[model samples]
Target: MNRRQFLCTTGAFAGWSGGVACQARAEAYTVDRALVLVDLNGGNDGLNTVIPIGDPLYRALRPTLAVPHDQVLPLDERTGLHPSLGPLLGAWRGQELAIVQGVGHDAGNRSHFRSRQIWDTASDTHEYRDDTWLAHASLPAASFVASCTDAARSIAQHEAAVVRIALHGFDTHENQALRHAALLGQLAQGLMMLRARLIASDDWHRTLVMTNSDFGRSARENAVGGTDHGAAAAHFLMGGNVRGGLWGAAPRLNALDTGDGLPVSLDFRQLHATACAHLGVAPPSSVERFAPLPLLRV
Candidate 1:
């Protein structure tokens, strides 16, 4: 049979009815899950977006910048959304989004550069000397969209996806910010396309984005000005199966004194555990060691 026919026949098992050969090719792969991680680059503040407006201390500390308790989009009594993150509100409203608050590794470094590196490498301060961070496994099989020529190389050494694209620069749009966001959206779409290309299965799972900086960073720093790193930034799980709602405590700005930044409720180790589990790796710390957070359940 031709490739198209082969894909069509196989896609039937994944519940897809299509003449597209790619669909059949996709069906051939038994493992069809994906994980898309994005870095916020600079440390994104969690406190601003997932605000704990109920806490008077929160308002007290950021008297000038605090999101008005009334103005914030209330997810619950304590948690609220920054106005700019309206797009995420839908996910929250649907209960598919799980916002694990207080998720920073304990004793996090406040320095933007160092903290970001630690997060990207997923290494503890102690293990920093051992280079274990560089030993991260490559993105799970067929789980990457090569965005750069160096993408393959980076993944080869560090075991991560560094997606590349062919788009050229030098846009003259009067609305630079809008244009930039548009380009990024397009880039995400392209990456999604690449992801789809890598899949050869009918039962394709959803995609997710993980990063150190929270969504609130772009709004606060780029739009507002300087930033102070906070704990427990917002993460996104985009797929058909996401639970779609707020999960985790709102950022406790008042509790900043407890650490260099707001304390994390969802342990980063737990997130690692969820990632491993999503890759179909079973638990009890046999394959990998990480704390189990509720991220997977949602």
Candidate 2:
């Protein structure tokens, strides 16, 4: 098509008057890009994982549980990460890790079964849905996986658009100090290896890795050096397309909920919306109302 012919055919594409080039960018999924969901099966203790090292309340609330100041991987003056997550520092430094803090629903439940249902379906506390949130978004269903390496391979090979990997044993009701550290260590190692493989295969930019859980553990340490079921946990989003750094406020340790849980600062649905849009797809009808976070590169 010559200039005049092209202008006549596509001039109105973006309300163009033919003085300059007009382009149309469709809002649809890029079939080649993959979304991987990592489920931290049991409730993760957000406080210990993403420590507020500068907060005096953190030490007071978890005298036996708080990660020591020096040992915490410093992210800022007020925030730090668990030493076990050191492997993720490269992603952090490379601006591939975006941390979403205090994420939960206002009507969040303490029961693991009920809360998991809410997250899985992306429904209101009083609502119920048999299908998953991704199904509502009209995306492909996730492929179940036992290994991050396997999931990374699939993404690299273009085997799946969506994959779910579950890591169990986050419920730390006893001996949490040791147990939680080990679990975080495993998570960091798996993600590091998975990221390395993706980077090697040239799939890192087209792949997004997100982590989730049933809920968060309580802010206050228990008598047995552990935490109970709580709310408002932290989550991570990693990919070359990500705009890394902290996205939400660190929970106020001084002002916990009645259940001794951190206050829900950012709605989890917002995350769903952001993820959907990040993939160049519109969010599901229910999730459309929530504002998408600016966590991804344009």
Best by lDDT: 2
The residue-by-residue lDDT of candidate 1 on 1-298, one tens digit each, is: 3324323333232221111222223333332333444444444455664677677776555545666677787887867766655555544565555666666666666566566555545666454532222112222222223342222333222222111123322121122233333443443444444334332222223334344352132122222333444445655443334445666566655455443356566656566556545544443232146655555544
Q: Supply the global lDDT for candidate 1.
A: 0.45
RMSD of each: 10.6, 10.1
Q: For candidate 2, what is the lDDT?
A: 0.78
> Model 1, which residues run further than 4 Å from truth?
1-31, 129-205, 214-225, 230-234, 258-260, 282-287
lDDT per model vs. reference: 0.45, 0.78
TM-score of 2: 0.86
Off by over 4 Å in 2: 1-30, 135-146
lDDT of 2 by residue, 1-298 (tens): 2223322322233212211121221112224556777888889999999988888999989889999888999999989999999999999999999999999988669988989888877788998877566631111212222277777766665444555677889999888999999899989998988899899999998888888899998999999989999999999999999999998988898888898999999988888887676655655666878998888887
